[model samples]
Every structure is written in C-alpha cells, then in structure tokens.
Target chain A: MLAFVITTVLCFITYLLLTTGSGTLGLWSLEEILVGAILSLIVGSLARTIFVKDNFRMLNPVRWIIFIAYVIGPFFVAMAKANVDVAYRVITGKINPGIVKISPDLKTDFGITMLANSITLTPGTLSVDVDEDKNDLYVHWINVKKKALEKKPVNYRYVCGKFPNWIRRIAE
Target chain B: MIFNLIIYILLAIGVFFNLLAGVGLLRFPDVYTRLHAGTKCTTFGSIFICGSVILIGLRMWYTGSTDGSVLAIHTIFALVAILLTNPTGAHAIARAAHRSGVAPVRAVVDDLQNNTLKKEEEK
Candidate 1:
C-alpha cells in the first residue's frame, strides 16, 4: 500500500540521517545501506498503519515543507513570545491560571493531534484533554484573559495565534 | 569571530530559557503549571542549543571538515527527536494528571467530567 511505501522511505531516510558519515558512499557504506534498507522495510511494514491511517496526504512533500515552515515561522515566533510571557509570570508571580474549552473544529485525527501538540508546546497553554466525539479541546490556560470569556465565541487568539489555521493548511 | 559570537548568543538564549524553566518549576504552584514550565521551556531551549551546534557543524563543513557535516546532521536528528517526543510526553503527563483528578489551581471551569458525562448519556 501507499502507507507501507511511505513509511519505509521515511524510516530509511531517518536511518540514513542518523547514520550519516558511517560508511564510504558519501554518507553511507554499501553494507550499511543494505542493512538500513532491510531494517526500514521490516519496521515500515509493522508501523505503517500507525503513521498513516487511511490517507496519504501527510506523505506529500508540500505538506512536509509547510510543516517545516510552520515550525520555523509562526511556531518559533510564538514560542519566543511565550517564553517571554512565562518568564515574566515566573518572575512576578502574576498568573491567573484556569481551564477552558475551545472548539477548533478539526475533523481529521492528524489535524487534531497537530493542533493539540502545538497548544501543548506553546507556553501558557496545555491541552488537558480532547473531546473525541465533538472535536473540542480543553486547554489549561495560564493567563485566561477576561475578554476571552466575553467574546462572541471565545477568542482562541488569546491562547494560540494562527495555530489552527496552520494546522488546517498542513494537516487538514 | 562573528560566527562564534552568534553561536554564543544562541547558546546563551538557550541556557537562559532553560534556567527560567527550572525557576518556573520551582516557583509554579500546582502540577499542571509545573508541567507547563517543565515541558515547553526546555523544548524551546533545547531547540536553540541543538541549533547552535548545527551551526558550528556547518561552519566546520564550510571550512572543509567533512566531520562537520556529519556532526550537524546528527545534531539535527537529535533536535528532531526532541521536538517530536517532548510535546507528546507532556500531553501524556497532562492527560494522566487530569485522569487522576489533579485539578488546576484557581481553575474556573472543569468541563472534562461534564463532557464525559454527556458522552455517556448520549451513548
């Protein structure tokens, strides 16, 4: 299947990256390549379903590029801002922490997982739980802004900016 | 000299954030908040630290050291491993803590139980 091939290729690439400069052929030896190929095939066949469920969209090079951009661009910027915010909170002891729910409305499992991981990775917010049936995320927010509650639909911008949009682009 | 200076700066930022993470872990009130400090700060800090090492490797490679390329690439793999695992570990911890009935301090709402109840009723 497509999933099996993609997982094999990915596992092999990871193997190659991990074993760089170990052999003679620029980065890998002929023997190492053979070993890696055999290992990758074995692992790929066993773990293909875990990586890709029913869709191969995630295997697209475009999605990977978008994911890289997501990491280096907005995610990095947000992380910096969050580090500052958390550092300030740690210093001044001025934090109003609480849990709140947000509905990102992501359908796919990968999209939901990506959004949850992003939320957990960023400072000031931890994704405490997910409502699998309704696709709602319950996030523990460090500084739960008052406006977030009063807004027409609870501004998620207060928690994570553009994260859902990027998840949509990359995973959805 | 400039490259070294840049690498130093990156390393400094990484160390500073990691130090802040440690401080936050000590100062934060509850388990959930401490998890926040423990996970995100370290992850962000490690990314920069590994990134600086990658930079060093690239510089060496550019200077005709073949090992430099290998060093950089391996550091990248380590970075990738950290990035992939850290958040997932945090998620697992948070979920476990919640499931075990550890509530956030001063939390205004607890919808998790209510949602579960709703799902049960619907079923």
Candidate 2:
C-alpha cells in the first residue's frame, strides 16, 4: 500500500514535469492537480500490480549506489578493453572463429542480463543464447582460445573471466 | 538559452548511447549477447533522442510555430513503438538461438534443449 502511494506520487511528479506545469483548458488550477493525483494513483497501482511481484524484496539503498558505481567503473573499463580487442581483430583478421559455451555461476535473471549485456558490449564476441535452466551461455567468438578449444571440457574460466563476478555486483 | 542547452544535452546523450549500441554489436561474443546490447541500449538511447525532439517541438510550439505540437506528439508515439517492439524482438532472437543449439561456452547442462528434445521424441 505504501509502495502504491510512493509510486503514485512519483508518477504525479513526472506528469507535472512532462506537462511543464501546464494545466488543461488554459491556466493552472487546483482541479487539475487533484485530477492528476487521482489518475497517477490509479496508474501507479496498476503498474505495481502488473510489473512488481508480491515476493519481491526491496534492496538497501546503499546497494543501489554500489551497483551504479560498478556500472560506471568496471563495466565501462571492460567495455573499453573489448573495444580495442575487437578493433584489432577487425583490422588484422586474427579471428579463430567458432561457437563456445561459458557456464557462469550467477543465478538471478538480472545478473545474467547484466553479464550478457556486458559481454555483448564488448567486441569480437556475440552472445548467441542462454540456457536458462543450466545458467549457461553460448557465445560466438571471433577469436577463440586455441588451448581451451583443444581441451575437452573447455576451460571457460579464461573465456568468461571476471565478467559474471562483476555482473553479480551490479545486478544480483 | 537554457531550453536550447537542455535539448542539446539530451541529444548528445542519446547519440552517445546509440554509438555504444553500435560498438556493442561489433564487440559482443555471441548472437544473443549482441541482440541484448544492441536492442536495449539502442532503445534507451532512442528514448533520449525522441525526448529531445519532443522538447524542441514544444519549444517551437511555445514560440508560435504551427507544426510543433504535431511533431512532438508523433515523436512520442514513435518512441512508444520502439520501446514496445525492441524487447519482444530480442526475446525472439534469444529463443531462436537457443533452439538452434548455440550453447554458451563452458555450460554444464542445458535444460531447455533436454526438454525440447524430450518433447520431440514424444511426438
């Protein structure tokens, strides 16, 4: 119920911002504010009921701050590194191309999403698919690790590296 | 001047994110990952771009331009369309990739494939 109220308030505030403080029928009016509040309350309740599950637990605010920090920090750095690697591959055509699987230990959907998105942002690798039940991802590598590919039970430790760990920080 | 600054800032942010999506397409490791990055980032970036356009249109409307309102509203509709379709398309691509047996590197067990194969044999 409290979540509904907060959501409604936020929606109302956004409505005001988007409308640029303007009221319908030419002038700002108290009636408009009241109508906006009521409308937003209904919309917020609908949104809460539809998108948010009942069992969802709210995280500590500090955790969110940490998550954003990781997104800006390590994630960006990884993206930059991938950029260089991909650019080199594009120029030199040094790709040992093939499909490979990497099993990440991350459990949650959001964590997996973050990992997948981070991987996709990097060059020379494409996330082909995810086996949700097994928590595995199939990636098409522009440059495969020769040693890992040669070995049965490929050492994906090298392929996936610190990605899933970093993703855990941001999303899980 | 402040309005112009805000519009320009939104435009720059939108363009930057769009470039990130493009780079993501070139760099990511697999088809599914590429779709994830390409779809979500582009959608986000497009929101900002369309937002800026809306702002500019509103500003023009305020300054007595006749076409501003129509332009602003249309851009918003387009933004909504992109938001609605992009994720659904990405989900389809991911499912197709999985069905095609492009497994993740180092994955231990594939439950989806097992289930699908089971269903196939039942038929």
Candidate 3:
C-alpha cells in the first residue's frame, strides 16, 4: 500500500508537470487534476512493484539533494569534456577503442544502473555489459589508457573519475 | 538584449554538438564507437538546447507571464526524460550488439568476451 501510494504520487507529479498551464487553477485545471489523479492511480497500482522494488533508500530527500548536486557538478563537467573529446576524435579520427571490465564494488542493482547510465553520458566510455553475479561492468572505452589496466579488473576512477564515490554516496 | 544573446549562444552550442553527434555516427568505425558518438553528443547537445528554452521561460516569468512558468517546468521534465532514457537506450544497443557477436572494430582488448569464454568453460 505504501509502495502503491508512492508510485501514484510520483506519477501524479509527473502528470502535473507535463500538463502545466492547461488550466487556471494555479497552472492546472479541475478537469486536468481529476484526470491526472485517476490515470496516475491506475498506472501506479500496476507499476508499484517494479517501480519501488524492495529498496526505498532512494526516497530519502538527502539522496535526492546529493543526486542534484552530482548532476550539476562533476557530471556536467565530465559531459562537457566528453563532448570535446568526441569532437577531437571525430575531427582527427584518432581512437584507441577497446572493451575493459571494472568492478565498481557497488552492491545494489540501482547503484550499478545509475553508474552505467552516468558512465555512458559522462565520458567516451559506454557500458556494454554487466556481470550480474559480481556486479561487474564491461565498458567500451574510446581511449584505452594503459594506466587503467596496470591492475586487473581496471579501476573505476580511470574510466569514470570520482563517479563511483558520488554514486555510492547517493545510491548506497 | 543580453538574454537574446545568451539564448543564441546556447542554441548555437546545442546545434553544433548535435551536428557533431551525427558526424561521429558516420565517422566512427563500429557499433560501440558509433554509439559513443550518437548518444553522448546528443545528450549533451539537448542539455544546452533545453537550457536555452528554460532560460527563455524564466525570462518570460520574470516579465510576469504565467505561461512561462509552465513552459520552463515542462522543459525541465523533458530534459530529465532525455537524460534518463538516452543513456539507457545506448546501453541496450551496446549490450545487444555485443551479445549478437558483433566485435568492436580495432579493439586492442576485449575483456567482456574473455569473461564470457571463461564462464562457458566453467559451465
């Protein structure tokens, strides 16, 4: 029931965000509100299990703040650098492409997922696969650094600088 | 006037990055590298484009237009959606390509394949 309510509320918020300025009731109309409520409830009930899962640690507001900080800070900077790196490669056609594996030591599926998504967006590395048993990630690196492979399983820092720590603080 | 200049600059950056994404897609040699181009560039480009829209909306709201509030909020949501889905989609494509026996062209190393081989041998 808690999960149901949580999912419903989240869905409703999303609906409201989408339907903003549709009515005079402070950016939402009575009809819009009513429709949104009903739709979100239905969608929420159906999606509660999948959406909420067993771990609700993400519901903590502090984690949300950290996530926002991460997006604005290191994440944004890395994305800019990633673009420039890609642009350089695109123009000069220089690449040392390879697939390397790294164990971020993240325990939860959510953390791994977040890390993978962040890795994809932030650098020349794209997450290619996962080792579910050990929670290992296979990363497609545009530039394979020799220092990164000086040790086995590689290092998360070399692939995604300081991201694992940030994700750990937020997700774990 | 200053806002217009900022918006123009943001739009130019956004368009330039998006165009880079397209060029990278064509210029890269393999599925993984192309995805590295297609996904990251577009995601970064969209951020700038949406940032410009959000700025416009904020300016309008500052000028006392209620509709601008909705516009800015909605644009933020769109940006969040792109941020969430784009990378996941890229991951899916990369995973599928790897699993379907497509090798990374000119790859100096392939640990994922070695892992798979080890798993197969273990079984």
Candidate 4:
C-alpha cells in the first residue's frame, strides 16, 4: 500500500513536471490533470513491487535534504576536479590503468549501486563489475596507486574520496 | 546584459569540455578509458549547458514571463535524468565489455578477470 502511494505520487509529479505551462488551470488544464492521474495510477500499479524495493528509508524527507546538499556541495566540487583531471590525462597521455576490487561494507543494494555510480563519475575510476554476494566493487582505476593495493582489497579513498561515507549517510 | 554574459561564459566552458571529451574518446586506449571520456566529460559539460538554459529561464521568470518557470523546471528535470542515467549506462557497458572478454589494454591488474574465471568454473 505504501509502495503504491509512493509510486503514484512520484509518477504524478513526473507527469506534472513534464506537462507544465500547458494551460492556465494552475499551470495545468483539467484534461491534463485527469490524464496524468489516470496514467500515473496505471504506472503506479504496474511498478509498485519494483519501485520501493522493500525499503522505506529512502522516502525520508531528511535523506532527501541530505541528498540535495551532497549534490550541491561536495559532489559538485569533486565532479569539477574530475573533469580537470580527465583533461590533464588526455593531454599528458600518461595512464597506469588497472582493475581492483574494494569492499565498501554497505549492507543494501542501493548503497552499493550509489557508490559504484559515484566511482564511475569521479576522478580516475570506472566501475566495471560487482561481487554481489560479497558486496564488492571492481573498479577500473585509470591511475593505479601502489599504496592502495597494499591492502587485501584496495581502499575506496584512492578511487573515490569520501563518497562511500556520504552515500552511507544518504542511502544506507 | 549581465545574464547574457554569464550564459555565454557557461556555454563556452560547456562546449570546450564537450569537445575535449571527443578528443579524449579518440585518444584513449581501450573500452573503459573511452567510457571515461564519453560519459564523465559529457555529463560535466551538459551540466553547464543545461544550467545556462535554467538561468535564462530564471531571468525570464524574474522579468514577469510566467512560461520561464516551466522552462527552467523542465530543463532541471532533464538534467537530473541525464545525471542519473549516464553513469548507469556506462557501468552496464563496462560490465558487458569485461564479460565478453574484451580486456582492458595494457592494464597493470584486473580483479574482475579472476571473478569471471571463478564464475565460469562454477558454471
């Protein structure tokens, strides 16, 4: 029931966001609202099982606020630096590439997924595969660091700086 | 005038990074590196481009054009979609490439290869 409601609301929001400026009826026409509600209901019912993933923690308003802050704050700075790093590597043509595994110790699939995606977009790393049972990520690091690999599993910091910690706050 | 100036600067930086992505794509050695170029650079570049559009919309809204809010909001939604989907798609591609035995060129190490071999043996 919760899943259904969440999905319905999310779908309706997406529909509304897409169809803005359509009419003067409070930024939507009566027809648009009716069509959106009916469409969202259909989508909501179909995706209810998959949409929520048996997790209600993500629906927390506090997590959403943290997520926005992370995006606007550290995440944006890291991305800008990543672009400059990539630009430097492109110009220098000096790369020591390798795939190394790291255990992030995240309990949930969402956390692992978020970490992997963050690694992929950040400096010097691309997520290539996962060890699902162990919750380990196999990252292709553009510049392999000797210090990180001294451990059994490479440290996440050498690949992504403080991202898993932030994701733990937001997702875990 | 100031808003247009800001928009122009954003557009310039966005275009430069996008073109640099193209250059990196052509120069990179292998699949994963190519993805680094194709995905990250484009995402960064698109942020600036979409941001400029959002700024334009904001300026218009402040100047009493009601349509501006819709324009800005919709562009933001599009930007969010790109941010969410681009890296996921690249991850899929990287996984597929590794699974198909397309090895990273001149790699110093490959932990995924061991996992694949172990999985294959189990199968």
Top lDDT: which candidate number?
A: 3
Of 1 and 4, the candidate ranking higher by lDDT: 4
Candidate 4 wrong stretches, greater than 4 Å: none
Model 4 CAPRI rating: medium
Backbone clash pairs for candidate 3 read: none
Model 3's i-RMS, to one decimal, reads: 1.1
Candidate maximizing DockQ? 3
What's the CA error at residue A113 for candidate 1, in Å? 1.1
Model 1 chain B weakest lDDT span, ten residues long: B108-117
Cα error, residue B96 of model 3, in Å, equals 1.3
Per-residue lDDT of A117 in model 1: 82
Model 2 off-target regions past 4 Å?
A2-17, A20-36, A54-58, A150-157, B1-91, B94-123
lDDT of 4 by residue, A16-100 (tens): 9888878889888889999999999999999999989877999889999998898899888888888999999899988999999
Better of 2 and 4 by DockQ: 4
lDDT of 3 by residue, B38-97 (tens): 999999999999999999999998898878988899899899999999999999999989
Question: Which has the higher TM-score value, candidate number 2 or candidate number 3?
Answer: 3
Return the lDDT, model 1, position A84. 86
Q: What does the lDDT read for residue B37 in candidate 2? A: 51
The order of the candidates by TM-score, greatest first, is 4, 3, 1, 2
Model 2 Cα displacement at A33 (Å)?
5.1
True contacts kept of each: 0.66, 0.06, 0.90, 0.74
* Model 3 misplaced regions, further than 4 Å: B64-66, B118-123
